[model samples]
Structure formats: structure tokens, C-alpha cells
Target: MGVDFDWVILGILAAFIAYSLLTKAVDRSLLTLPIIFMGVGYLVSDPLRAAAPPEILSEGKRLLAEFTLVLVLFADASHVRFSQLKQNWQLPGRMLLIGLPLSLIFGTLAVYLISPEGGIAMALLTAALLSPTDAALGQAVVSSPDVPERLSETINVESGLNDGLVLPVVLLGAILASAGVSDANTDGLAIAALIQIVLGPLAGIAVGWSVARLLDLAQTRQLIAESAEGVVFVATAFAAYVFAEVIGGNGFIAAFVGGMVFGNTYRHHIRFIREFMDGAGQLLTMTSFLVFGALLLPDGIEHATASAVIIAVLFLTVVRMAAIWLSLLGTGLKIKEKLFLGWFGPRGLASILFTLIIMDEYVFANADELLACVSMTVAFSILAHGLSSTPLARRIGKT
Candidate 1:
């Protein structure tokens, strides 16, 4: 059989160049990229053309989203300064303890009231999935050194940590909702969840620390080459993920914790590793946005009901703001700072990943409704928050 190898290679190259060009445009107009790509997907889909295979679109989108989240979780965690985190642990602590749970509770109640077709458990699952904010999605806000270091650090740390912290809740909620609370294997699930949560960090620390020490020794012996350092960095992250998953731990958590431990333990090597992983992670994140546009958006839009739209809006604005307001009450932050921090907690990768995991692992009674709810919420967040992030940060700085 003759293969059209040249045509395939040319097409791949062309697509990459086109995507790179699109990235420049995306930087200029943050709101346009997702909206345009989404429109392209909708226009090109089977509804518009009967010849298009739906599964091709579906599978491609799902895979891109999964990989994107993994890279983002790792990169975000790696950039966190462990020393700074030590000094300001209270911010993240309050966020995980006070803000996150309240967000879930309020989100669940809001979904229940808004989604007439969704049950209580399903509502909670939806809430749990959307509870954690994504710092990567709103880099403008979280990365602004113009903002108070304390505020930025708090949001950054919370965004990095809360995503991992909320994984067990999402898993538990999905299990209870999908398998039926009575029939669910809570004991086994709980044990597995605990192991995944606890072991993920331990595995990351052990692997990252050991590798850092080995690299240090290798450098002392003049055995470590410049190129090999990059390889070691990638290997550390990959090993952390694979080993944790092999033991039924959370790979995302492992990647994050591993990156953190590696960053801390191997501060000298971090410049090399962080740059490579971050570039790789950005590529993955962009691919994710494309897939999200192509696959999730179209289906989510078709399934979107009035209830779904209302819930998405409420979750993005009212529910989240309320939870943040309550969480920051005694923290002594100014009113402007509180509002700025609260409004900027954009939900992105973690929600997308958790939703994908739920779909893969369990069959919810209202799968479509749950998916629709999460998808709409995420889409809104990416757009609404992406557009306002820069301006909002500037405004906060002025105030």
C-alpha cells in the first residue's frame, strides 16, 4: 500500500505553523481564540456536514484536555516557591479549609435550585468539579507582580494546591452520584482515595529528592551534561506520575508535588527543568484549548438548557463571589482586595480534568446534564475571566 506520507507531514507542519500564528493573535485578543475555534468546530461538525465522523472529534478533544491538565498542574506546582509558601501557608490553608468547602456547598445548593432535572448528589458532584480555580487560565491576574505579593501569592498557592486538594471530593461525589449512595463501595473507595492523596505527595517527594541528590552527585563528578539535565527533569516528573499511578495514587497530585519537591530540593537545577517543562506545558495547554473548542463546546452547547446557562452564570459570578466574601471575612484584606481576589478565581483545567475523569470512571444518571453544567461553566470562565484579568489587576493596583 502506498502511503501519502508527504501530504500528511506537510499538513501537520502547516497546522503547527498556523497554530503558532494563532497564538500571537490569541495574545492580542484573549477573548477571540476560544470563541473562534468553537465556532469553527460547530460549523465544521456533522450537524453542518454529514460526512464528518463525530467520534474523531470527541476522542481528540478528550485526549487533548487530559494531557493539557496534566502539564498545567505540574507547571503550576513547580513555579510555586516553597520558601514563600512556608512564610504564607495561612492563605492557602484558609482557602483549602474555608473557601473551598464553602464554594462546594454554595455551588451545590445553587445547582440544585437551578437545575430542576439534577438530583442533590449530581448537584454536589457538579459543584465539587467546578470548585477549584485554575491559575494558569488567568495568568495575567496571578502573575502580576504589580499586585501585592501576599495577595498574588495567596491566589497562586491556593490555585496550585486546591486543585489537588479537591480531587478526593470530586471522586467521592462522582461515586456517590453515579453508583447510587447505597450501592457505592465507600470503604474501598475511601481507602483508595486516601492512599492516592497521601501517597501522591510522598511519592513525589521521595522521587524528586532522590533524583535531585543523584543529579548533584553527578554534577560533582562532572558526569552530568547540560542536555542530560533536561532529560532528568522530564524523567523526574514522568517517574513521579507513573509510579504514583502504578500504586493507584493521583498522578496529577504526584506531578505537582514532585515538581514542588524537585524545585525546592534542586533549586540550582530548577532553571533548566522549569523552562523545559513550562514550554512543554504551554504547548499542551494550547492544544487543550483547541480540543475544548472543537469537542466539548459543541456538545455542551447542544445540550445547554436554560437551567444550564443560568447555573453557569450563577456559579461563575454569584456563588463564587459569595463564597470568597465569606472566606475572606476575618482575613483583614481590604474590600477592594477581597473583591479582586474573589472575582479572579477562574475555573479551568482542574474542572475539565475532573469532568473527564468522572465520565471515564462512572456513568452518572444525569451524565449529559452534569457534563453540560460543567462545560458551560468552564467556557464562561475562560472567556469572562480571560478578558477582564488584565484590566482588573491594573484597577486593583491603582486602588
Candidate 2:
């Protein structure tokens, strides 16, 4: 019943090649890259389990999840133009500032009442984990010509920024959950988190600016190969993340801020950098989803209870929609537009990464149930959002 690692690699290779060929067609249909890979992973989970030990598999998952998130945050943030952001920051700003906090509050309340097994700390933790939206999940809509530019940009920007913005909250949640919020040194934790947040961006700026200057000198002196820029670019991301972590800062935030600084500073080379990173990112993303389906999803599904399922449903729909709708009140968007924005807040990579972080770092009385709820929400989001994206993007494009 054992599957060899060679066979597993071959299978993944074949699946990726086939998917690449059918990518355009798949994009046109309701099926998505995540759905496809997740299914493939689920189907092969048993065989893979026979091949790898639990600890090895867990470590593999952690590395894959972390690297995937690092690249994603970096790439996404790099694409955001500061000038454009300044011009259109209103919509995303409101969502991040007003909508995000409301979502956290509402999500915590919902979890507290609906899934009381985890207590308030777990409730807050879960809420913080799920609050950030995933741009990868909404790629269809954001990239679609049919969707309004402003709308797509708003969603894109929100996704790019919110994960970094909320990382502290997630850290706080874990600290509080471990110590029990009442017994925890809440003030000290807050100060520590605040310091990490501040230091992350500072490290990012230093890495980004230094790297950009080096690249500029190299290019000017014709000392570096065009092909090698990609290597440097990827290295910069890792460097920013590692440097930040070394300085007791949040790596993800450093990656994001580094990307922003890199993108802005290395303007002439952005296209080359993105071309290389995008291909790599796509591969990492697909592999991460595959691992998720094979391991995380199964575990979550197995441990999920009735309350977990209920909370999952509410978090995706009621909690998300209400927070979005309320945040856009004075923006004068039509009901359909508001709903469109609300509905597309799909949970994917960030949530998955946060769940992994919880599994690794935190000890919750209701850890299994907490992850189950988040996992269920992510699964539902993958299907619901994937199926709806293309058609909805088309529908909204006409309006």
C-alpha cells in the first residue's frame, strides 16, 4: 500500500503539465487551479501518507506554507503602485480600516456564541485568522475585463495589505489563547507585537533599498546578467523575511514592505522581476493547495463538529457580508455592487497559513475544533468563490 516518492513527484509533474495546457479553458469554466489541485491531493492522500512519516509531512507542509505565503505577499505588494494607491485608497482603506475591525468584532462574537467550546480567546484567534482576504481566490474577478477596474483594484489592494495589517492581531490571539486572555500579560504582548510591526517595515525598507541600489549599480556597470536579476529578486524576498525575523520582527510584514520598497525603488526592472516570480509563485501556490487537500483539509474535516460547521457557514456568509456592507455605507455603491464586493472576499492562502501557524505554535483546548471551523470555511470558500467568480465577473462587467 506504500507509494514511492518518485511516483508522487511524477504524479505532481504530470498534473501540473496537464493543468498548464488546459489553464485557459479551465479559467473559462467554473473550475479553478485550487479546486483541481486540492482534489488531486485528496485523491492521493492515502498513498502519500504511506510514503512519508507524519513529522516529515508536517515539516514539509510548514515550509511549503511559509515560503508560499512569503512569495505571495511580496509579489502582491510589489504590484501595487503607490501613486495608484494614493488615488484609489479610499475604497480599500475603508474596507481595511472600518470593514476589517467590524469583521473581527462580528466574527469573534459569532464564534463566541455559536462555537463556545473554544472560549473568547479562541474566538478572537479564529476571527483574526480568517479576517484577511486572499487575492489568489479572487484572481478571476480581479483579472477579468468585465469587472470594474475600481472594484477589482479595491479587492486586490485590500487583500495585499490586510494580511500584514492583521498579522499583529493574529500574534496577539495566539499569545492570549495560550495564556488565557485574563491571565496573560496583555500589555506586554501588545507592546511586543507593536515593536515587531514597526521593526518589520524598517527592516523591509533597508533590505529593499540596499538591494535596489546594488542592482542599479550592477546594471549601470553592465556587471549583472539580465537572467540573474530574477535570482537576486527572489533572494531579496528571503533576505527581507529572514532579516526581519532575525531582528525580532514579523517576517511576512517585512516581505510585504520589502516588496513595496523594492517595486518602487526598482521600477525599471519590475517587469522582469514579476515575470520570473509569477511562474514560481504559481507553482508554489498549486503545490501548497495540493498539500492542504492531502493533509490539512482531511484532518479538519474529520475533527469538525456541528458547531464548527455552523460557524464556518456564518463566517463565510453573514459575518463577511455584513461587515462589508456596513463598511461601504456612504460610498453610494448600489446594492449589487456592495454585494459583489462582499461576496468575493474569499478565504484561501492566508487563512491556510494562519491555521498552520496555530497548529504549530499555539496550544488551544479546542485546537481541533478551531482549525476545523477555519478549514471548513476555506473549503467552502474554494468551491463557492471559484464557481461564482467567472460568471459573476461577467455579470458585473455588463453593469
Candidate 3:
């Protein structure tokens, strides 16, 4: 019914055609799909932006980004084998419990130093926004045939769990960053965080267990539909998120936990679900980037200051690497392995959604600056990590 919709449809179609033509060339080069979509989004945005105005478009972009993440969280947790999680649990455990918090702490300090005038809350908001990593950003790193299985699995699980784990922190920071954030509102936010963290996993376990039992019954009776097979699996993924949100829990965390439980409880059925996601995931991930380039990144660039640009680069390099290195120090990992892990923490969809939540839900004096820093950070991450993914993976694999 509006302008941005038509433009996005055509733009994606055109991008696909161009992608088809350039597929071989891109595969042979350092160019990633995100880089292409983002470039196209920036180019076509001015004329094609929605007639509904700024706020509606921003909300639409946020929802698209959120949906992309929902699918990713569900798929990632479900895909990895239980054996892998049990064996390498310590790496990701230390990562989620120790490394992520350190990154936020160091990132907050760095941002506060960079912009002491922006206040502690603003710095916290910026660091919290930037802390989570995006596995999708470095698809080659996680999904490549050449990469070591344990290494890829480690990154996959770490990224999958971190997005949900970091939500409470981001929500707290956002509330504090709000202009008139009161003690009462802060108390309410803390309560919500507690519900999200605790209930999200519990609800996920309940839903995922239920879904597994239902699917088992269908399979035992040979009642599973051929035409609806994919749809059934897709429903399984969304069911976890919907169920959690309905019960005052965090949908993202539910999606991740539901996938883990669903996958393990019905390991035999995972293949069908993975097939469905493999087909749909690329489309969704690309669409999010396209919308990001056209709708979100431009606004971010408009608001960017020199300070934001510097902080963004610092995040991709110093902030993430230092945290990963410190956390992995006594884990028996080598210096190169540690550096490789550190260098690959690219920020993507999760960061976009977090920033959008701020823009939508709350108003702050330094909101523009916070978003600008996030936007710039993700944009740089796409390029820096995308180009380096293949080359670094090859080097690491050889090691």
C-alpha cells in the first residue's frame, strides 16, 4: 500500500538478479552478500523510502530485523549436536558468562572516555548495543566446509546464546539512558529482565518439549503431511517465540532454548527443519541487510560524528578482541586461536534490533549518537569481517 514496500520488492529482485550474475565473481572475491545488499540499499533509498514517513519505516525495519533474528536464534540452537555442546561447553560457557560482560565493561569504559559528556548511561547503552556478536555476518566462518568443526561450532553456539543473554543488559541500559528514567521505571525494567531471563528458558523448555511430543505422535502414526512438512517445522520455530512472549518472557531467549530442546528431543526430525531454514534463511538474512542499508544505515550515517566512527572501529578491533583473549587465556587455546576468535566477533542483526528498540520505545538526548555509533559499528563489521572471513579461515584451518 506504500512506497517503501514496492521499492524493497523490486530492489530485492534486482539485487537477486545482480547476485545471480555476480555469484561466481563474488564467491571468488572478498565481497559478501551483506556488503552488496547494504550498498544497494543506500543507493536506492532516497527515491523509494516509504510514503508513510520516518517513524513507520523505522518500525518496519525493526520488525524485519527482529524476525530475521528470531529465525536465526531458533535455527542455530537447533542445528548443533548435543555432543558438540557438551564437549565444547566450557569455551562458550566462559564466553557467555565471562567474555561478553568483559566486552561490555571495557566497551563502556572506552565509550565513556570517548564521550564522557554523553554520561554513564549513554556509554552503557552504546556498549550494551555493541556487545553481542552476529554469526550471520560471517556466514563463511561458521558454515564453511573448510573450517574446523569445533571452531565453527564454538562461534555458532556463542553467537546464538549471547544475543538472548545480553538482552537484559541492553534493556537496563536503555531504560537508564532515557531522559526521565525514574526509580519506579527502573524497578519495573529489572522485574521484566528477571522474567525474561528466567521464564524465557523455562517456557522454551516447556514449548520445545511439547512440540517434540506432538511431532513424535504425528511421525509414529505416519500422519505427517508431505505438503505441510516444511510448514510444520517452521511453525515449531515460531511457536517457541510466540509462546514465550505470550507468557511475559523474552521471545528471543525462548526461540534459542526451544530450538535446543526441540532439536535434542527429536533429533531425527532436525534434518527437515534445517532444510526448511536453509532455503528461507538466506532470503530473510539478505532482506534484513537490504532494509538496513536503505532505511536504517542512512539515518545512522546522518547522525554519525567523528567520535562515533572512531568508537566503531575500536569496537571491531580492540573492544571485542581484548575480551575474547582475556576470557580464553587459561582455556588451553593458542595465541593465534585466541586472536582468531577475538577478531571474528562481527556485530549484525541483534545490534540493529537493539538500536531500533531504543529508537522506538524511549527518547534520550544522546539517542542519535548511540544509534549512530551502533550503525557505524555494524556497517564496518560487515566489511571488515566479511572480507577477512575467508582469508582468515583458510589461515586458521592450515594452523
Candidate 4:
């Protein structure tokens, strides 16, 4: 079969690149990359969308989402400041330990109330899927000089680690639900989850440690080139992810663990490496958002009830904020600061990727509902978070 879709992909990429360039030309604008890319993707796909195969679009979206996430996860985790983490452990500690679990609970409750059609298993799956935050979605806040370093650092660390930590829950939920879900059987999911959660970190440690040692050796021997130094970090990240998945481990966890280990061990090399991959990941993120807009948004809106949309808005506002309030009770942060932290837990890449795994597994029971909820929540997030980030940053930065 002669595939012409390659041309379509290239065209979309080129157009977005140009759009991004033009956006960069105009300074101090509310137009975010996600909004622009999403609008374009939606516009183009609206015409010729049905001409594309569902599987192909779905698979392509999943791959793009996966690549974006793996890169971002590694980059985010590797940049964590251990010294700061040591000092400010109370902040991130409260977030990951308390805030994360509460968010999971809130997600479950939200799903249960909003999507009454989905089974308990499905509710659990959706909850697990949305439990983790996406730092990439709020990159402005994290990367900005204006934002308080402590707050951004805490959020970044939470985003970097929570997704990996929640990996097993997402898998286990999917597995338990598989029995009644179309042709899926719940035979090996538990074992799969166990192996993945355990082995992913082991693989990451091996890859990250070995690469750090190798980089050091190369530096001592003067074997490193200017351009190729970046490759070492990139290669290590891809290696950790691919190796873990090849061995049936959780690649995302492997990448996250690998990034964390690499950053902590070889702190010197990571800044340059992160800079290189951050740019690449941004491009990938743009494309992922575009693809999501074109395909997933339409599907989400179609399948979603007005009630589901309302629940999604509520999920973004009340559910996450409440989780933050509870988690930060004793942190001594001002009410405004707590609210700032709460409002910024924007969901993006990881949630979408987790939801897509359901489709990849051909999950059949209330799959539509699950997909709808995931899509609606994420789409709402990309818009709401993207829009609010700048003004909120200005407001919070002043404090």
C-alpha cells in the first residue's frame, strides 16, 4: 500500500513550525503554543479526518504522546536540585506523599460521579490516568524567572515523579477491568504490573549509572565532542526507556528513574543535556497537542455529555485545589500561595498517554466513556491552564 499520509504529517509539521516562528515574532501575547497548534490541527483535520484510518491516527497519536512524555519525564526529573530537595523536602514531600494520593481519590470520586456509566474498574482506571500532573503543561510557571523558585521547583518535582510512581496503579486498574472489557482478559496484568514497576527502576539505574560513568570517562580521555556530548544524555534516556520496555518493564518509570539518578549523580552534565532535550521535547509537545486537538477533541466532544464537561471543569478547579489545600495544611504557605500551587496542577501528556493505552489494549467496556473523560479533561486543561498561566504567574510572582 502506498502511504500518502507521510506528506500530511510533514505538511502539518511545517505549518506549525511557521506558526511557532510567527508567534515568536510577536512578543507579549496571550496566544500559547498549545492553543495555536491545537486550533490548526483541529482545522486541518476537520476536513480530511475521516479519510485517515482510525487505528493509524490513534497509533500515531499514541506514539507522539509517548515520545513527548518520555523525553519530558527524563528532562524534568534530571533537573531536580537535590540540595533544594533536601532542604525543601517538606513541600514536595507533602505534595507527592499526601497531595498525590488525595488527587487520586478525588479523581476516583469525580469519575464515579461524572461518569456513572463506567464500572468501578473504569472509574479506577480514569482516576489513575488523571492522578499525575503534567509539568510540561505549565512550563511557563516552572521555567519562568518570575515565578517563585520554591513553588515551581515543588510542582516540577511532583510532575516529574508522580507519573512514574502512579504507573503501577494505572496498569493494575486496567488489568482488573480487562476481564469484562471486550476481548481483554485479566490473566497476566498483575504479574505484568509487578515486573514493570520493579524492573523499570532497575533498568533506569543501570543505564543512568553506566552512562554517567561513561561520560566522566569520556571527559577524562578528551573523547567527547561538542555536539556529541548532547547525544550521550539523549542516548541514555532512550536506552533506559527502550531497555526497560524490551524487558517488559515500565519504560516511563525507567526514564523517570534514569533521569533522577543521572541528575543526582552527574549534576554537572545535566544542565546542558536538559537544555538540548527541552527544545526537542517542546517541538514534540507542540505536535502532540496539535494531534490531540485535531482528533481527540472532536471525539471527546462527541462522546461527552454536558454533565461530563461540567465534571471536567470541576475536576480542573475544585478537585485539584481541594487536594492541594489538604496537602499543604501545615506548610505555612499563605492562602494565596496555596491556592496558586493548587490551581497550577495542569494535566497534560501523561494523562493522555495513559488513556491511550486503554485504546491500544482494545479496552471495550465503557472505553468510550473513559476516553471521553480523559480527552475532555485534558482539552479543558490545555485551554484553561494555557490561558491562566501568564496572568497567574504575574500575580503570584509579585507576591
For every candidate, C-alpha RMSD to the true structure in Å? 3.9, 2.3, 2.8, 2.6
| Residue range 166-258, candidate 2, lDDT tens digits | 777898888778776344355576677778889999999999889988888889889998889888888999999999999988888899899
Q: Which pairs of residues collide in candidate 4?
A: none
Off by over 4 Å in 4: 1-11, 23-27, 48-51
- CA deviation > 4 Å runs, candidate 1: 1-62, 181-191
Q: Write one digit per residue (lDDT tens) for candidate 4, span 113-172.
A: 776677677777778887788876677788778889988888888887888778778877
The lDDT, on a scale of 0 to 1, for candidate 2 is: 0.86
What Cα-based lDDT does every candidate model obtain? 0.73, 0.86, 0.81, 0.79
Model 2 CA deviation exceeding 4 Å by range: 181-194
Global Cα lDDT for candidate 4: 0.79
Best-to-worst lDDT order: 2, 3, 4, 1
Flag regions of model 3 displaced more than 4 Å: 1-8, 20-24, 50-52, 179-187
Between candidates 1 and 3, the one scoring higher on TM-score is 3
Q: TM-score for all predictions?
A: 0.85, 0.94, 0.90, 0.92
Better of 1 and 3 by lDDT: 3
Show the lowest summed lDDT stretch of 10 residues, model 2: 180-189
lDDT (Cα, 0-100) at 3 in candidate 1: 38
Ten residues in sequence with the least summed lDDT for candidate 3? 179-188
